[model samples]
Target: EPEVTQTPSHQVTQMGQEVILRCVPISNHLYFYWYRQILGQKVEFLVSFYNNEISEKSEIFDDQFSVERPDGSNFTLKIRSTKLEDSAMYFCASGDTSGTSTDTQYFGPGTRLTVL
Candidate 1:
Protein backbone atom coordinates (compact mmCIF):
# COMPACT_ATOMS: atom_id res chain seq x y z
CA GLU A 1 0.00 0.00 0.00
CA PRO A 2 1.90 2.97 -1.24
CA GLU A 3 0.23 6.31 -1.02
CA VAL A 4 1.03 9.96 -0.46
CA THR A 5 1.09 11.88 -3.70
CA GLN A 6 0.08 15.40 -4.51
CA THR A 7 0.51 17.97 -7.20
CA PRO A 8 -1.66 20.51 -8.94
CA SER A 9 -4.61 18.71 -7.37
CA HIS A 10 -5.92 22.24 -6.95
CA GLN A 11 -4.34 25.61 -6.58
CA VAL A 12 -5.57 29.07 -7.41
CA THR A 13 -3.32 31.71 -5.98
CA GLN A 14 -3.66 35.47 -6.39
CA MET A 15 -3.63 37.15 -3.02
CA GLY A 16 0.08 37.86 -3.03
CA GLN A 17 1.57 35.38 -5.54
CA GLU A 18 4.15 32.73 -4.78
CA VAL A 19 2.97 29.15 -4.33
CA ILE A 20 4.68 25.82 -4.60
CA LEU A 21 3.00 22.79 -3.19
CA ARG A 22 4.03 19.32 -4.12
CA CYS A 23 4.64 16.03 -2.44
CA VAL A 24 5.54 12.38 -2.98
CA PRO A 25 6.15 10.89 0.35
CA ILE A 26 5.81 7.22 1.35
CA SER A 27 8.79 5.65 -0.27
CA ASN A 28 10.15 4.02 2.82
CA HIS A 29 9.07 7.02 4.87
CA LEU A 30 11.74 8.67 6.90
CA TYR A 31 9.63 11.24 8.65
CA PHE A 32 8.27 14.23 6.77
CA TYR A 33 5.21 16.36 7.15
CA TRP A 34 3.43 19.61 6.44
CA TYR A 35 -0.22 20.04 7.09
CA ARG A 36 -2.99 22.56 6.78
CA GLN A 37 -6.74 22.51 6.78
CA ILE A 38 -8.09 26.01 7.06
CA LEU A 39 -11.38 25.27 5.44
CA GLY A 40 -13.50 24.02 8.31
CA GLN A 41 -10.66 24.07 10.84
CA LYS A 42 -8.45 21.43 12.54
CA VAL A 43 -5.29 19.77 11.22
CA GLU A 44 -2.62 22.44 11.61
CA PHE A 45 1.03 21.54 12.18
CA LEU A 46 3.16 23.29 9.60
CA VAL A 47 6.50 21.64 9.13
CA SER A 48 8.82 18.80 9.97
CA PHE A 49 11.65 17.36 8.00
CA TYR A 50 14.38 14.91 8.75
CA ASN A 51 17.98 13.92 8.00
CA ASN A 52 18.31 16.90 5.67
CA GLU A 53 17.40 19.36 8.41
CA ILE A 54 14.50 21.09 10.09
CA SER A 55 13.28 18.43 12.47
CA GLU A 56 10.38 20.53 13.67
CA LYS A 57 8.53 23.73 13.05
CA SER A 58 5.26 25.26 13.97
CA GLU A 59 3.71 28.60 14.82
CA ILE A 60 2.35 28.37 11.36
CA PHE A 61 5.90 27.92 10.19
CA ASP A 62 6.47 31.64 10.00
CA ASP A 63 9.05 33.40 7.87
CA GLN A 64 6.71 32.89 4.97
CA PHE A 65 6.93 29.15 5.40
CA SER A 66 9.11 26.84 3.36
CA VAL A 67 10.05 23.16 3.27
CA GLU A 68 12.05 21.23 0.78
CA ARG A 69 13.40 17.81 -0.04
CA PRO A 70 13.88 18.55 -3.72
CA ASP A 71 15.42 15.18 -4.35
CA GLY A 72 15.31 11.49 -3.60
CA SER A 73 11.69 11.61 -4.67
CA ASN A 74 10.42 15.14 -4.02
CA PHE A 75 8.74 17.12 -1.29
CA THR A 76 8.21 20.84 -1.29
CA LEU A 77 5.95 23.53 0.04
CA LYS A 78 6.69 27.17 -0.30
CA ILE A 79 4.35 30.08 0.14
CA ARG A 80 6.62 33.03 0.37
CA SER A 81 3.73 35.37 -0.16
CA THR A 82 0.09 34.63 -0.06
CA LYS A 83 -2.59 35.87 2.22
CA LEU A 84 -6.35 35.84 2.35
CA GLU A 85 -5.87 33.70 5.39
CA ASP A 86 -3.70 31.57 3.07
CA SER A 87 -6.75 29.49 2.30
CA ALA A 88 -5.91 25.85 2.73
CA MET A 89 -6.21 22.10 2.35
CA TYR A 90 -2.57 21.49 1.88
CA PHE A 91 -1.27 18.24 3.35
CA CYS A 92 1.67 15.96 2.76
CA ALA A 93 2.88 13.46 5.23
CA SER A 94 5.12 10.50 5.80
CA GLY A 95 6.04 8.74 8.97
CA ASP A 96 8.27 6.56 11.04
CA THR A 97 6.16 7.11 14.11
CA SER A 98 8.95 5.88 16.27
CA GLY A 99 7.18 7.42 19.21
CA THR A 100 4.75 4.54 19.15
CA SER A 101 1.03 4.23 18.45
CA THR A 102 1.58 1.51 15.92
CA ASP A 103 3.29 3.66 13.28
CA THR A 104 1.50 5.18 10.39
CA GLN A 105 1.14 8.63 8.97
CA TYR A 106 0.83 8.47 5.27
CA PHE A 107 -1.25 11.21 3.78
CA GLY A 108 -1.38 12.99 0.51
CA PRO A 109 -4.03 13.88 -1.94
CA GLY A 110 -4.39 17.45 -0.97
CA THR A 111 -3.27 20.72 -2.42
CA ARG A 112 -6.29 22.88 -2.52
CA LEU A 113 -4.88 26.28 -1.70
CA THR A 114 -7.07 29.01 -3.04
CA VAL A 115 -6.05 32.36 -1.72
CA LEU A 116 -7.78 35.22 -3.41
Candidate 2:
Protein backbone atom coordinates (compact mmCIF):
# COMPACT_ATOMS: atom_id res chain seq x y z
CA GLU A 1 0.00 0.00 0.00
CA PRO A 2 1.07 3.53 -0.69
CA GLU A 3 2.13 5.72 2.25
CA VAL A 4 3.20 9.25 3.04
CA THR A 5 6.95 9.80 3.07
CA GLN A 6 9.03 12.53 4.71
CA THR A 7 12.69 13.22 4.03
CA PRO A 8 15.75 13.72 6.23
CA SER A 9 13.84 12.08 9.12
CA HIS A 10 15.71 14.60 11.20
CA GLN A 11 17.06 18.12 10.74
CA VAL A 12 19.40 20.34 12.68
CA THR A 13 19.61 24.07 12.09
CA GLN A 14 20.89 27.20 13.68
CA MET A 15 18.50 29.81 14.97
CA GLY A 16 17.36 32.28 12.29
CA GLN A 17 18.23 29.92 9.45
CA GLU A 18 15.60 28.65 7.08
CA VAL A 19 14.63 25.02 6.75
CA ILE A 20 12.44 23.20 4.29
CA LEU A 21 10.78 19.95 5.23
CA ARG A 22 9.64 17.66 2.43
CA CYS A 23 6.77 15.24 2.09
CA VAL A 24 5.08 13.12 -0.54
CA PRO A 25 1.47 12.46 0.39
CA ILE A 26 -0.39 9.37 -0.62
CA SER A 27 -1.69 9.44 -4.16
CA ASN A 28 -5.46 9.92 -4.63
CA HIS A 29 -5.66 11.68 -1.29
CA LEU A 30 -7.51 14.98 -1.35
CA TYR A 31 -6.40 16.63 1.87
CA PHE A 32 -2.98 17.28 3.34
CA TYR A 33 -1.99 18.64 6.73
CA TRP A 34 1.05 19.61 8.77
CA TYR A 35 1.23 19.07 12.51
CA ARG A 36 3.97 19.43 15.07
CA GLN A 37 4.64 17.99 18.47
CA ILE A 38 7.07 19.82 20.69
CA LEU A 39 8.77 16.94 22.42
CA GLY A 40 6.25 16.04 25.15
CA GLN A 41 3.47 18.34 24.01
CA LYS A 42 0.37 17.39 22.13
CA VAL A 43 0.36 17.34 18.34
CA GLU A 44 -0.81 20.70 17.13
CA PHE A 45 -2.21 21.39 13.73
CA LEU A 46 -0.29 23.89 11.68
CA VAL A 47 -2.11 23.97 8.37
CA SER A 48 -4.33 22.06 6.04
CA PHE A 49 -4.45 22.40 2.27
CA TYR A 50 -6.94 21.19 -0.27
CA ASN A 51 -7.78 22.15 -3.84
CA ASN A 52 -4.50 24.03 -4.04
CA GLU A 53 -5.24 26.58 -1.34
CA ILE A 54 -5.06 26.61 2.42
CA SER A 55 -8.27 25.30 3.90
CA GLU A 56 -7.32 26.11 7.45
CA LYS A 57 -4.35 27.23 9.51
CA SER A 58 -3.72 27.51 13.20
CA GLU A 59 -2.27 30.48 15.04
CA ILE A 60 1.08 28.76 15.11
CA PHE A 61 1.28 29.12 11.35
CA ASP A 62 2.60 32.62 11.57
CA ASP A 63 4.58 34.82 9.17
CA GLN A 64 7.59 32.55 9.42
CA PHE A 65 5.85 29.56 7.92
CA SER A 66 4.56 28.67 4.48
CA VAL A 67 3.62 25.60 2.51
CA GLU A 68 3.36 24.63 -1.13
CA ARG A 69 2.82 21.83 -3.52
CA PRO A 70 5.94 22.32 -5.59
CA ASP A 71 5.05 19.51 -7.98
CA GLY A 72 2.44 16.90 -8.65
CA SER A 73 3.95 14.63 -6.06
CA ASN A 74 5.82 16.78 -3.59
CA PHE A 75 4.60 19.00 -0.77
CA THR A 76 6.90 21.23 1.21
CA LEU A 77 6.87 23.36 4.35
CA LYS A 78 9.35 26.19 4.72
CA ILE A 79 10.24 27.99 7.91
CA ARG A 80 11.66 31.41 7.15
CA SER A 81 13.47 31.79 10.47
CA THR A 82 14.05 29.03 12.90
CA LYS A 83 13.96 29.56 16.65
CA LEU A 84 15.00 27.27 19.48
CA GLU A 85 11.32 26.82 20.35
CA ASP A 86 10.71 25.71 16.79
CA SER A 87 12.28 22.35 17.45
CA ALA A 88 9.72 19.58 17.18
CA MET A 89 8.64 16.54 15.26
CA TYR A 90 6.89 17.79 12.17
CA PHE A 91 4.44 15.31 10.78
CA CYS A 92 2.94 15.23 7.30
CA ALA A 93 -0.42 13.61 7.02
CA SER A 94 -2.98 12.75 4.36
CA GLY A 95 -6.72 12.35 4.78
CA ASP A 96 -8.57 9.39 3.46
CA THR A 97 -10.71 9.93 0.37
CA SER A 98 -13.25 7.21 1.06
CA GLY A 99 -15.79 9.74 2.36
CA THR A 100 -16.07 8.02 5.68
CA SER A 101 -16.32 10.02 8.86
CA THR A 102 -13.84 7.64 10.38
CA ASP A 103 -11.42 8.13 7.52
CA THR A 104 -8.35 8.50 9.63
CA GLN A 105 -5.27 10.37 8.65
CA TYR A 106 -2.11 8.53 7.74
CA PHE A 107 1.05 10.09 9.10
CA GLY A 108 4.63 9.96 8.01
CA PRO A 109 7.15 8.72 10.56
CA GLY A 110 8.03 12.39 11.06
CA THR A 111 10.94 14.77 10.59
CA ARG A 112 12.45 15.83 13.87
CA LEU A 113 13.57 19.45 13.56
CA THR A 114 16.21 20.57 16.03
CA VAL A 115 17.21 24.20 16.25
CA LEU A 116 20.32 25.37 18.03
Candidate 3:
Protein backbone atom coordinates (compact mmCIF):
# COMPACT_ATOMS: atom_id res chain seq x y z
CA GLU A 1 0.00 0.00 0.00
CA PRO A 2 1.15 3.55 -0.68
CA GLU A 3 1.62 6.06 2.11
CA VAL A 4 2.41 9.76 2.53
CA THR A 5 6.05 10.74 3.05
CA GLN A 6 7.69 13.89 4.45
CA THR A 7 11.25 15.17 4.52
CA PRO A 8 13.41 16.63 7.28
CA SER A 9 11.84 14.47 9.94
CA HIS A 10 13.07 17.02 12.45
CA GLN A 11 14.00 20.68 12.22
CA VAL A 12 15.52 23.06 14.77
CA THR A 13 15.54 26.76 14.04
CA GLN A 14 15.61 30.12 15.72
CA MET A 15 12.78 32.59 15.70
CA GLY A 16 12.25 34.54 12.45
CA GLN A 17 13.89 32.01 10.18
CA GLU A 18 12.16 30.47 7.22
CA VAL A 19 11.36 26.79 6.97
CA ILE A 20 9.92 24.60 4.29
CA LEU A 21 8.35 21.27 5.12
CA ARG A 22 7.92 18.86 2.28
CA CYS A 23 5.61 15.93 1.67
CA VAL A 24 4.73 13.38 -0.99
CA PRO A 25 1.35 11.74 -0.77
CA ILE A 26 0.14 8.50 -2.28
CA SER A 27 0.32 8.80 -6.05
CA ASN A 28 -3.39 8.57 -6.75
CA HIS A 29 -4.75 10.66 -3.90
CA LEU A 30 -6.68 13.81 -4.90
CA TYR A 31 -6.70 15.77 -1.66
CA PHE A 32 -3.69 16.94 0.34
CA TYR A 33 -3.64 18.60 3.73
CA TRP A 34 -1.36 20.05 6.36
CA TYR A 35 -2.02 19.86 10.06
CA ARG A 36 -0.03 20.66 13.16
CA GLN A 37 0.05 19.69 16.80
CA ILE A 38 1.72 21.81 19.39
CA LEU A 39 3.44 19.85 22.16
CA GLY A 40 0.42 19.72 24.43
CA GLN A 41 -2.29 20.93 22.07
CA LYS A 42 -4.70 19.20 19.77
CA VAL A 43 -3.89 18.58 16.14
CA GLU A 44 -5.27 21.47 14.09
CA PHE A 45 -5.97 21.65 10.42
CA LEU A 46 -3.87 24.22 8.65
CA VAL A 47 -4.77 24.00 5.02
CA SER A 48 -6.07 21.77 2.26
CA PHE A 49 -4.91 21.78 -1.34
CA TYR A 50 -6.53 20.34 -4.44
CA ASN A 51 -6.38 20.82 -8.18
CA ASN A 52 -3.23 22.90 -7.69
CA GLU A 53 -5.01 25.49 -5.59
CA ILE A 54 -5.97 25.98 -2.00
CA SER A 55 -9.36 24.47 -1.34
CA GLU A 56 -9.69 25.37 2.33
CA LYS A 57 -7.68 26.90 5.12
CA SER A 58 -7.95 27.43 8.83
CA GLU A 59 -7.38 30.63 10.79
CA ILE A 60 -3.96 29.34 11.60
CA PHE A 61 -3.02 29.56 7.98
CA ASP A 62 -2.24 33.25 7.57
CA ASP A 63 -0.15 35.42 5.30
CA GLN A 64 3.00 34.09 6.88
CA PHE A 65 2.29 30.61 5.66
CA SER A 66 1.87 29.18 2.20
CA VAL A 67 1.70 25.83 0.42
CA GLU A 68 2.53 24.66 -3.04
CA ARG A 69 2.50 21.57 -5.17
CA PRO A 70 5.55 22.41 -7.23
CA ASP A 71 5.23 19.26 -9.28
CA GLY A 72 3.01 16.24 -9.67
CA SER A 73 4.67 14.41 -6.80
CA ASN A 74 5.78 17.00 -4.27
CA PHE A 75 3.81 19.18 -1.92
CA THR A 76 5.38 21.69 0.42
CA LEU A 77 4.44 24.11 3.20
CA LYS A 78 6.59 27.18 3.63
CA ILE A 79 6.64 29.41 6.65
CA ARG A 80 7.92 32.83 5.72
CA SER A 81 9.07 33.53 9.23
CA THR A 82 9.15 31.15 12.14
CA LYS A 83 7.84 32.01 15.55
CA LEU A 84 8.11 30.22 18.89
CA GLU A 85 4.39 29.57 18.59
CA ASP A 86 5.01 27.79 15.31
CA SER A 87 7.00 25.06 16.93
CA ALA A 88 5.08 21.85 16.53
CA MET A 89 4.86 18.54 14.74
CA TYR A 90 3.57 19.21 11.23
CA PHE A 91 1.74 16.38 9.52
CA CYS A 92 1.03 15.79 5.84
CA ALA A 93 -1.98 13.79 4.76
CA SER A 94 -3.82 12.80 1.62
CA GLY A 95 -7.01 11.05 0.59
CA ASP A 96 -9.44 10.55 -2.23
CA THR A 97 -12.37 12.93 -1.78
CA SER A 98 -14.57 11.11 -4.27
CA GLY A 99 -17.85 10.38 -2.59
CA THR A 100 -17.20 7.30 -0.52
CA SER A 101 -18.23 6.34 2.96
CA THR A 102 -14.80 4.87 3.45
CA ASP A 103 -12.84 7.98 2.62
CA THR A 104 -9.91 7.98 5.00
CA GLN A 105 -6.75 10.08 5.05
CA TYR A 106 -3.28 8.60 5.29
CA PHE A 107 -0.85 10.73 7.28
CA GLY A 108 2.86 11.06 7.05
CA PRO A 109 5.18 10.42 10.00
CA GLY A 110 5.36 14.20 10.57
CA THR A 111 8.08 16.83 10.69
CA ARG A 112 8.87 18.09 14.13
CA LEU A 113 9.79 21.77 14.03
CA THR A 114 11.45 23.24 17.07
CA VAL A 115 12.07 26.95 17.53
CA LEU A 116 14.54 28.49 19.90
Candidate 4:
Protein backbone atom coordinates (compact mmCIF):
# COMPACT_ATOMS: atom_id res chain seq x y z
CA GLU A 1 0.00 0.00 0.00
CA PRO A 2 1.15 3.55 -0.67
CA GLU A 3 2.05 5.68 2.33
CA VAL A 4 2.17 9.40 3.01
CA THR A 5 5.39 11.33 2.33
CA GLN A 6 6.67 14.43 4.15
CA THR A 7 9.53 16.67 3.06
CA PRO A 8 12.44 18.09 5.02
CA SER A 9 12.09 15.44 7.73
CA HIS A 10 13.47 18.02 10.15
CA GLN A 11 13.32 21.80 10.12
CA VAL A 12 14.96 24.34 12.40
CA THR A 13 13.67 27.87 12.33
CA GLN A 14 13.93 31.02 14.38
CA MET A 15 11.01 32.02 16.52
CA GLY A 16 8.43 34.06 14.58
CA GLN A 17 9.63 32.63 11.28
CA GLU A 18 7.26 31.09 8.81
CA VAL A 19 7.34 27.46 7.82
CA ILE A 20 5.54 25.29 5.37
CA LEU A 21 5.31 21.54 5.83
CA ARG A 22 4.55 19.49 2.79
CA CYS A 23 2.95 16.09 2.40
CA VAL A 24 1.76 13.80 -0.30
CA PRO A 25 -1.13 11.74 0.92
CA ILE A 26 -2.39 8.52 -0.56
CA SER A 27 -3.54 9.03 -4.11
CA ASN A 28 -7.13 7.98 -3.48
CA HIS A 29 -7.86 9.20 -0.01
CA LEU A 30 -10.64 11.73 0.43
CA TYR A 31 -10.04 13.02 3.94
CA PHE A 32 -6.85 14.80 4.91
CA TYR A 33 -5.70 15.90 8.34
CA TRP A 34 -2.85 17.75 10.00
CA TYR A 35 -1.78 16.77 13.50
CA ARG A 36 1.02 17.67 15.83
CA GLN A 37 2.77 16.13 18.80
CA ILE A 38 4.63 18.35 21.19
CA LEU A 39 7.53 16.19 22.31
CA GLY A 40 5.95 13.83 24.87
CA GLN A 41 2.43 15.14 24.65
CA LYS A 42 -0.47 13.35 23.02
CA VAL A 43 -1.12 13.89 19.34
CA GLU A 44 -3.46 16.80 18.75
CA PHE A 45 -5.59 17.46 15.73
CA LEU A 46 -4.96 20.78 14.04
CA VAL A 47 -7.25 20.68 11.07
CA SER A 48 -9.07 18.49 8.60
CA PHE A 49 -9.62 19.21 4.93
CA TYR A 50 -11.80 17.54 2.35
CA ASN A 51 -13.13 18.37 -1.08
CA ASN A 52 -10.80 21.38 -1.22
CA GLU A 53 -12.25 23.00 1.89
CA ILE A 54 -11.70 22.83 5.61
CA SER A 55 -14.04 20.34 7.23
CA GLU A 56 -13.02 21.09 10.79
CA LYS A 57 -10.29 22.73 12.81
CA SER A 58 -9.18 22.63 16.41
CA GLU A 59 -8.64 25.62 18.64
CA ILE A 60 -4.95 25.05 18.25
CA PHE A 61 -5.38 26.02 14.63
CA ASP A 62 -5.37 29.75 15.09
CA ASP A 63 -4.83 32.49 12.54
CA GLN A 64 -1.20 31.57 12.43
CA PHE A 65 -1.96 28.23 10.85
CA SER A 66 -3.54 27.26 7.58
CA VAL A 67 -4.05 24.14 5.46
CA GLU A 68 -4.32 23.83 1.73
CA ARG A 69 -4.36 21.31 -1.05
CA PRO A 70 -2.75 23.37 -3.78
CA ASP A 71 -2.89 20.44 -6.12
CA GLY A 72 -4.61 17.12 -6.32
CA SER A 73 -1.52 15.37 -4.98
CA ASN A 74 -0.12 17.74 -2.40
CA PHE A 75 -1.52 18.73 0.96
CA THR A 76 0.32 21.29 3.03
CA LEU A 77 0.30 23.05 6.39
CA LYS A 78 1.64 26.54 6.85
CA ILE A 79 2.64 28.17 10.09
CA ARG A 80 2.83 31.90 9.62
CA SER A 81 4.60 32.63 12.83
CA THR A 82 6.39 29.90 14.69
CA LYS A 83 6.66 30.12 18.43
CA LEU A 84 8.67 28.02 20.86
CA GLU A 85 5.47 26.21 21.69
CA ASP A 86 4.96 25.48 18.02
CA SER A 87 7.96 23.19 17.97
CA ALA A 88 6.65 19.71 17.43
CA MET A 89 6.44 16.73 15.18
CA TYR A 90 3.87 17.56 12.57
CA PHE A 91 2.15 14.69 10.85
CA CYS A 92 0.13 14.50 7.68
CA ALA A 93 -2.58 11.90 7.46
CA SER A 94 -5.28 10.77 5.11
CA GLY A 95 -8.30 8.56 5.43
CA ASP A 96 -8.99 5.84 2.92
CA THR A 97 -11.64 6.74 0.39
CA SER A 98 -14.06 4.46 2.17
CA GLY A 99 -16.65 7.17 2.57
CA THR A 100 -17.15 6.58 6.28
CA SER A 101 -16.33 8.50 9.41
CA THR A 102 -14.57 5.45 10.77
CA ASP A 103 -12.17 5.13 7.89
CA THR A 104 -8.68 4.51 9.16
CA GLN A 105 -6.18 7.33 8.79
CA TYR A 106 -2.67 6.57 7.60
CA PHE A 107 0.00 8.84 9.00
CA GLY A 108 3.23 10.06 7.47
CA PRO A 109 6.61 9.81 9.12
CA GLY A 110 6.19 13.43 10.29
CA THR A 111 8.16 16.67 10.04
CA ARG A 112 10.00 17.76 13.12
CA LEU A 113 9.94 21.53 13.57
CA THR A 114 12.23 23.17 16.03
CA VAL A 115 11.91 26.83 16.96
CA LEU A 116 14.75 28.61 18.62
Per-residue lDDT of candidate 1, residues 29-53 (tens digit): 7788889999888998898788777
TM-score against truth, every candidate: 0.31, 0.94, 0.94, 0.97
lDDT of 2 by residue, 3-106 (tens): 99999799999999999999999998878889999999999999988878998899999999999998888889999999999999999999877635576899
TM-score of 1: 0.31
Local distance difference test, each candidate: 0.87, 0.93, 0.93, 0.95
What lDDT score is found at residue 21 in candidate 4?
98
| Candidate with maximal lDDT | 4
Candidate 3, lDDT over the whole model: 0.93
The reply for model 2, stretches above 4 Å from the true place, is 98-102
Cα lDDT tens digits, model 3, 54-77, are: 988999999999999999999999
Query: What value does the lDDT take at residue 91 in candidate 2?
Result: 98
RMSD of every candidate to native, in Å, equals: 12.2, 1.4, 1.5, 0.8
- Structure candidate 2, residue pairs in collision: none
Candidate 3, residue 4: CA error in Å?
A: 0.5
Write one digit per residue (lDDT tens) for candidate 4, span 28-113: 99899999999999999999998999999999999999988998899999999999999999999999887587889999999999
